[model samples]
Target: MVFKELRIMRGPNMWSRDHHNIIAVKYIPEDIPALSAEQFHAVQEYFLLNFNDQQRSEQNTLSQFKWTIRLAALLQDKNFSHDLASPSPDILYGILQYKTEQGGVAALETAAQIITALVSAKEPVSFLNASLYIKEINLRNDFGPSTKIIVEAAQARNIPVQKGPAGYIILGQGENQQRISAARTAATSAIATNIACDKEDTKAFLESSHLPVPKGVLTEDLSHLQEIAESLGFPLVTKPLSGNHGRNVTCKIKTVEELIAGFS
Candidate 1:
């Protein structure tokens, strides 16, 4: 069968410091020819220089290495062929799924498809090096039905699943893409489950528990915002009711325009 190039892109979670898994593009052997030797060497040097069998202490470096190694291996094995009598062509579509945590279920599924494709095509595919990450699982927020689909799919195949801070990273991709704001829902779920929510909720929850909240209410109307501001104090904060990361959320609104923008 002919080798087909593919690319898939995704975003990251907001509240988490790690960038959400951003892009999972795929390339064939020929694609690498376009990359200068310097770029190739840089890739090689990074994996070779950092990391050992020891567990990682720093999250940023750890996640970066895991993705780099996995991507390089997948690309190297692009031409791996499978036999004719095996099964469906869908398996041939090898995916390099980007994730925000160490052990990515989607990335594993992608790898599994490649193996299945090879087996059906009569080609040999083997697991190279599998690693794990310690992922923080928050309770409360519902993943809708999609989470169930992903979990079930992984389990049905008996694919090994491990968790970690492997795949999380925010894309600095800037204004072109829609900013992720689902963090509030995620934070609520996390707060319910015992995972620490972001600064805003953390402050609110902590204050409600025993401390002091600035007596703020979530609102979109500037008039109401001003009322709340007057009630609370001069230097009060008006922020998005739902926001993740420190990206779009602002602090200490001194003007109506800033308050309006944040609330809107």
Candidate 2:
């Protein structure tokens, strides 16, 4: 049997609410061989071999199949693990929900291909570097840690969410909705954002609010920084003004040599 197409869909796509993020396929119904109960047990048995004592992996025939697909993607290819969920499949469509960033597309494609081989009793493709491919896509598509936690929490609560421009999120429905990225909400003023982005200006902005400000002096000279460090004492934090995600940040310098090395 030949499989024609695979599709990745995000959100309330005519199927059901539970199928928020899904990997979908549309094919002639007869294309899929109706797996016998015994055949399914064999698949589950292989699953047990792949992941020792995995739970909630046998909720239904389709769930077992998903686990088989996940087994090849995570356990065999990546040596990684993710908590699996078995949201009830759509009665009409049988679409499967996935916890995903955009990277889910690559993962599902890899896993579906592997499971297709297994179900057809074909020799499984060997030495596929699916893990590397998945990792690369994830790096490009995955949310940063703070954003991920918020998004997952929203999903768990069944709050509607959609990816907005860049990596920002739109949550809830029209009237009750809000957009956010990192700690900034949709209402966070543009000028406030500009001030925060420029840490040098942020210090002054804080001072205006009667906040106790850290003493800071800007200088390009390494010798001037060393002199300042001597007065400030050890256990210092240093960062570039244009700091981007903790890059080039050196914390807790105990010795002058280490500080010099950090600057150098």
Candidate 3:
């Protein structure tokens, strides 16, 4: 099968209104045989394990299995009627809705890949190997350890957690929702952040507050940098006027040449 387009669909659609986060795949068909019962069961179990909890009953599992087969059939031909057992068309479209769990998109993509492989293969699929592969992919794409800890902490309190666009995490719901992006929060003071972002300003603020701060000069003029370094003495640090996380920062300059190199 030749993939034409694959995208994440959000908002109201035919399959569901509330559950809008779905992966839609469009493809130009090739000769694909019907999936065997064992292959179908394997694919069903794979999706359930990765996307949904195992606590779901046999009836729920069967329902999901039917849905999976329907979508799989549609991928080979949209016009192919499951009831009539008609021949598949030359073009097809498939949609798979996924839960907003830890892996989410990665899990959905892995399931799709595994299902396609199983559909075309002549032998039984190794679910263990497929699961391991998906686990590695999920680990690579998942949030950092710190972020995961925070998310889990929120979940422990029965707070609703959602993964927003651009890797933001939304905690709670409706009026109580709190969006956390990286280390910043909605209540984070912009004015204070600006002052703290500028090393010179931060140093000045600290000095004014009778707090210990290193003596440093902030200037775009590199010509007088050597003179300033001489006055401040050896073991100087050079950094951008406004920077974070040690970016564009050079430290431990004990000589004029080292200061110049640090500035450069």
Candidate 4:
């Protein structure tokens, strides 16, 4: 088995930021026996038998194994392309998206390892070892470095810290319960946050308040993009009307061709 790629995606992505941290792995299962209906069922059974342990309930483990089998089946089906060439070789791919509270990357990696073990029928695979590794990783990442600092500070101040669903932390309790998300507090202005989220809106608001802002026009039309770029002069910036963290944003667009490509 050859792993083609392994990546850990963090922050806001296609998946829910509050709930999911995805670990994506692409591998070629050349060493594994040919994927057949019988082989698929055997792999599924093997996964159920070997992967269950004290770390997770049997039901949850079965659920995860089912999902892995589905992915494997999807990849095994030759009708659909996995973005490879038409005459592509057989490939096995899997993605594990774990809840931030459940261990995130650690859980994802363990799941991938389980799938690999089942597919290849590899021996010396210990669920106990995997469980312990996941536990260690969970302990290390349960409270991220920044979150740990905040948790410690809250503890020092005698604020009751309670873990909430999807990586949220609640400081204090009952009516006095204050939610803490990274540096954001319960009192953080929702209107301000929304305004800050939209780059064009933020620019407009700042300009209205006599603050300096980049001169840019927002348009979805590619034809209009060139016109707007020409009006603004060369070396302009192109970005999605509403986005964050520089997603789909291209800067220093100096020519019409560059603007067109940047917009696309």
Q: Which tens-of-lDDT digit does each residue in 63-137 have in candidate 1?
A: 222333353333333222111211442332333333322233333443434333432343323334322111221
Model 1 lDDT-worst window of ten: 132-141
Q: What is the TM-score of each candidate against the true structure?
A: 0.27, 0.59, 0.38, 0.37
RMSD of each: 16.7, 6.5, 12.1, 16.5
Comparing 1 and 4 on TM-score, the stronger one: 4
As for model 4, its CA RMSD to the true structure in angstroms is 16.5
Residues 137-227 of candidate 3: C-alpha lDDT, one tens digit per residue: 5565555655677776775666666678887888877988899865467887998888877778888889999999877777777799868
CA lDDT, every prediction?
0.38, 0.61, 0.57, 0.57
Model number with the top TM-score: 2
lDDT ranking of the models: 2, 3, 4, 1
lDDT score for candidate 2 against the true structure: 0.61
State model 4's lDDT: 0.57
- Most accurate candidate by lDDT: 2
Evaluate model 2: give its TM-score: 0.59
Q: Can you give the lDDT of residue 194 in candidate 1?
A: 42
